[model samples]
Target chain A: MIKMRLLNGQPQNRISMADRAFQFGDGVFRTMRCTGGAIEFWARHYSHLEQDCAALGIVCPSASILLEDLSRLRPVDAVLKIIITRGETARGYSVPDQLLPNRIVQLAALPAYPEQLYQQGVKVRVCSTQASWQPALAGVKHLNRLENVLARREWHDPDIFEGLMLDRDGFVIEGVMSNVLVLSDNILSTPKLEQSGVSGVMCEVIFDAAVQHGLQVEKRAWTLDEIKQSDAIWLTNSLMGLLPVSDLCGRHFQSHAAQLLLSGALKQLRQKEKFAIVDLAGMTKG
Target chain B: MIKMRLLNGQPQNRISMADRAFQFGDGVFRTMRCTGGAIEFWARHYSHLEQDCAALGIVCPSASILLEDLSRLRPVDAVLKIIITRGETARGYSVPDQLLPNRIVQLAALPAYPEQLYQQGVKVRVCSTQASWQPALAGVKHLNRLENVLARREWHDPDIFEGLMLDRDGFVIEGVMSNVLVLSDNILSTPKLEQSGVSGVMCEVIFDAAVQHGLQVEKRAWTLDEIKQSDAIWLTNSLMGLLPVSDLCGRHFQSHAAQLLLSGALKQLRQKEKFAIVDLAGMTKG
Candidate 1:
């Protein structure tokens, strides 16, 4: 696979040993999809990155600078990962008097996923690892992702595509890498992420699309029992778009109507001029 | 200042961008003081590192291999930092089938501290940021330390030596970078770290020393109000052995007898044949 990476806006594949990201996981990152030389939902990704950086007191690089850096990779169907770290420090938790934020952008070949996963959906298991409830750091895609890493380690079977993680209080929060959606009685609801979980970009797009389609959309806390009783279940993220959960903890979900509706809306959004550069061929069809 | 670093037992100063430590904070680390070519409490530090790595399912490098790597640094008065990451993986959280843990060791000039900090103590303030409660990760010095970074960011005053962080329920846990100890009457108490906080190596040594000295010790939950009513407070860490907290949230403390007793015990420990290689001149005298 062809790999292209930039560190501090320069082509480089290595970072200093003292980089805060390497030391304390003191950073935030965005995993975006890039196709035909343009990024999918660049504006939204940038906005979210700004908010996440602000939450951690990091100075985010301007969109123009990041765009220039992305352009260095040229046109490609790839996974784009951007990491903004608080840069190198003199070996302590305190922010240095003179701080320089490190920007790392890497483009790699798009990961191949089994087509059947999108077409027939996937089975997911509940993870024993509970997400920590840190309201101060909740909802931001920061580098402190040990919880997600640990939760994802709960299963090794290729048959299971994702693991659902609950908060310390046993409230269903999110999937290991995606935001969750539950549809029941014409209502589209997702977990409230104010206490835990990352607020995924695709989840926001789905919420907006649901609102545009005259659907009742709600962001509230739900229990695992409530999730099992939902008519349909889906997971959303930038790379995977929307993946319906055919089986969750032995409770099978049959309805794909809500997933189809939201994915169709996302497809339409991709066709708009702002996102026209995205190559649909690069994405797996559901 | 002379600096020496090793990556996976080889001389190197940079790590691949794909290192899990940089991506997901998937690692554990230890910070120790080196004097006259010998690491302070090497056995305890190694034991803690092994336990921490085991907790995160990362294979720890053997003591002989790590000792050889440290030997490359030769005899020096410096600070030693060791990081063991789960190495790199294909673009996700799943652990790779064939895993190789990355061991990084770095030696740098010991940080200089004011003699007054050890003698008269330092002032500290309570941080507004609350530490997250992850029982699985509690007491282990794993790399998911954004909470500590955020808490350290809460204070910028040079006079304020450290910030005390509370857990989710407003119970005082530990300082941003050190374990806390409260002295009230004849009792020496520290927060129980079963819920949150890094169990500092020096804190453990102090606990053992207190017992040897016949001082009554207790480990339990404490609040800011209780901290204010304490006779004296102190912070302990590997680098900064122990420093009394003269002021906390405007409440001043005058007793230094407890601090002296503990420091004296540490001095005796340093005199042992096993620790004879340590250089007493390099430390700040209380």
Candidate 2:
């Protein structure tokens, strides 16, 4: 899945040893999907990147600069990862007065996940590694992701598509790399990331579409039993899009009507945003 | 303060942007003090590094390899930082079948902290940023230190030497960059890092010496109120050694006898180790 990489808009594959991201993981990143040379939800992704960087006190690179870098790649049907680090500075946690954030944009082949899993839904297990509670870092998607790495390492079963992680208080927060939504009757609920978990962009887009679809959206702490009791469970990410959880432990969530409804809405949203970008052609001219 | 950097073993100053350390903070690190070209408590530091790597499933570089790299620098009165990452691999959280850990050894000038701070004690304020609860990650000096970075960023006042952080439960944890020890009468107490916090090597040495000195050692959770009522508080790290906190949120700690006693013991330990290294001269030949 590996391909080309650009550091600070140049065709470079290495960063300074002193770079804060390499040294302290002082950075934020966005993993976006680009199809037919057009990135899905470009505006929302840039906005989220800015917010995540602001949360960490690192200056966000301008959208034009990132767009220019993206244009350089002219990615077609690829996974685009944009990382903005606090840049290289002296060895310390203290943010330097002269903030020089470095932008890294890379392209990789879209992962070849089996289509049958998405169609029939996937099987996920509850991870033993619990998520840490950091209200400050919660929902920002900063680079301090060792917890997720550890959680993902729990199972090597190719049969398990993803792992569900809970906060220290035993509240189910999110999937190892995806945001989760629980469906019951007309209410669509997801865990509030105020104390932990990354507030994913795909989850945001889904919630917006759900509201327009006349679904009552609820965001709060979710217990494991509550999750299991739901009519259906949907895991969403920028790359994977959306996948229903058919089996969690021994319980089977056979109802996937909610997943189909949201998947169609998500496709509509992606197409609408693609047509809305005035510079779509210009974005690839570089 | 950075003087030199060695990536892997050679004197290189950059690493692959795909390195796990930069990519996901998938790494562990050690910061040690090198005086007279000898790393203080080298054996203990190496053991801690091995344990931390094992905790995160990253392979630890053998000590002789690291010591050989240190000898290449021939560092004297410098601060040494060693970072071991899970190495570069294809994208995703799944641990690859093959693991190639990368070692980064760098040298920075020994911090020139104000001399009087150790003698008269320093003033510290409680940080607003709370340490996250990650029992699995606790005590490992991994590179996912955005918590410490955010806590340290809470204040820029040079008058305040450090900031004390509390866990989600409002219990005193540790300094933003050091382990904290609370002294009340004959009891030398420190927060148990089982829930959250990095267990500093210097704190370990102090506790060992404290036991030998006939002081009762207790490790458990300590509340803010309990910390304020302590006789004196000391912050310990590899480089800064030990510093007493004379004032915390206006509560004064007049006792310095405990700090003095520990300081003496630490010096003796360092001297004892220096004489114990038979390869001290050979180590610098590189």
Candidate 3:
């Protein structure tokens, strides 16, 4: 399938070299699954993108403007990515007075992960590379992702689906590309992103669904020892939806019980949406 | 004079959107001053840029290739910036097997700062935004500079020349756009960048000159209180050379003594360089 790329609504694959995003990674992006010509969880994605941009003082492009750009792709069963940059400018870190935000919309083939992995769960490993401690940038999916790239490079084993990252203080923060959660005593606990980690949209959705299913939810710091002792562990992101961690650092977890309960709650939420679903799992229609 | 930008030696301003630098800031850069068609400290600038790229596992372009690119610019008394990105690739963080680095050379008009800043020293304020700690990327000047952008946004006062940044642990790091050094008693000291901050080219030069001038140099953790009590403070960068800090956090400092001693030492060093006789001020032939 041919991929589609649009820069500022133009069918272009190039941006100015001096663009702040190219110069300093001064940008934020959203990756959403586009199914049957409609974006899944688009509202949640846009809201997160706006908040990320606002955290860096970059003015976000209006929702209508972005939606218009998405429509231009005429996407169907594709992975859609939207990038909002502070725009092109002269040299230096101080923002220019007259700011023009750049919007890039791209469409690619949807990743085809084996269906069995969703049911059987995937294996993960702890990364040696630690996440930087920046409270100001925590929870915002900004473009400065060198640490994530480095962590993702630590393992070459195809069986290890992801690498979990810890902050400098040895607190479990997140995965290289997704947010992580641990289940213990029926309590669903995700890391507090006030000091590190990207707070994924799906993670928030899982928290809401877990609450609806009468489960305790906690957002706080977690250590490697605490995670290893949990009843179950899960990894979440927009594209991959959610998956249980069958093995993490040689420790096995059985997440079938909690998965069924929350999956049902998520299906109920998906039914209220506009898109027609073929299969509903973990708040994502696949 | 018109600014010149060369992408891979081609006089163009656009780069592929898929370039890793535009995507994940997977790149390194160097900024230097050109005087009468000759780049100031070209060897040191290239060495630092190469080391930074190596730290990130990128292949540094040959010096001959970069020098040729600079020669194409026909730069005379301008600001030159060199950027090397890990080329272009499809989505994801995994480094592709086939790698090609992209080189960008840009020449811009030299900034015309009031000479009084160099003569009487400049006032700098302490930034509220703290630098993140990532030991792996501590000294490398990579493109993940959103923190710098955020810290620089703290002040808009024209009189405030720079902002001093501290790490998350409250240890002095560097300036928003430069490296900082403090002189106390008869010793010169700079922050240890093993856990935070960029180890700039000019900062290394200042340390060497301070040592040759019979002044002791120290690199270690420094607190705001300790910095406030120092005999004098200074900021260093490739473009600005070195400037004394006259005022910081409303406290005035007398840097005249240190400035006279170090500037004289730097002037003697410049006399042996290839560049003709000019105003040799703080290792910069301005």
Against the true structure, whose DockQ is highest?
Answer: 2
- Misplaced by over 4 Å in model 3 are A274-286, B270-286
Model 1: per-residue Cα lDDT over A1-286, one tens digit each = 3388999778898899889999999999999877665678888889999999999999999987887677666546788888999989767888876599999988888877666777798898999999888989989999999989889888888888899999888899999999999998899999999978898888888888889888999999999989999899998898888888999989998857667778888877655413422233233121
Candidate 2 is scored at a TM of 0.97
Tens digits of lDDT, candidate 1, B167-228: 88999999999999988888888999997889888998888888999999999899999889
TM per candidate comes to 0.94, 0.97, 0.94
lDDT score for residue A23 of model 1: 92
List model 2's recovered fraction of native interface contacts, to 2 decimals.
0.85
Question: Could you give the C-alpha RMSD of every candidate to the true structure, in order shown?
Answer: 4.7, 1.8, 4.9
| Candidate 3 C-alpha lDDT tens digits along A86-106 | 998889999977699899999
Best by lDDT: 2
For each candidate, what's the DockQ? 0.67, 0.85, 0.62
Best by TM-score: 2
Cand. 3 Cα-lDDT = 0.85
Model 1: number of backbone collisions: 0
Error of 3 at B210 (Å): 1.2
Evaluating just chain A, the predictions reach TM-scores of 0.93, 0.95, 0.93
Q: Which portions of model 1 show Cα errors greater than 4 Å?
A: A273-286, B273-286
**By DockQ, is 1 or 2 better?**
2
Model 2's chain A TM-score stands at 0.95
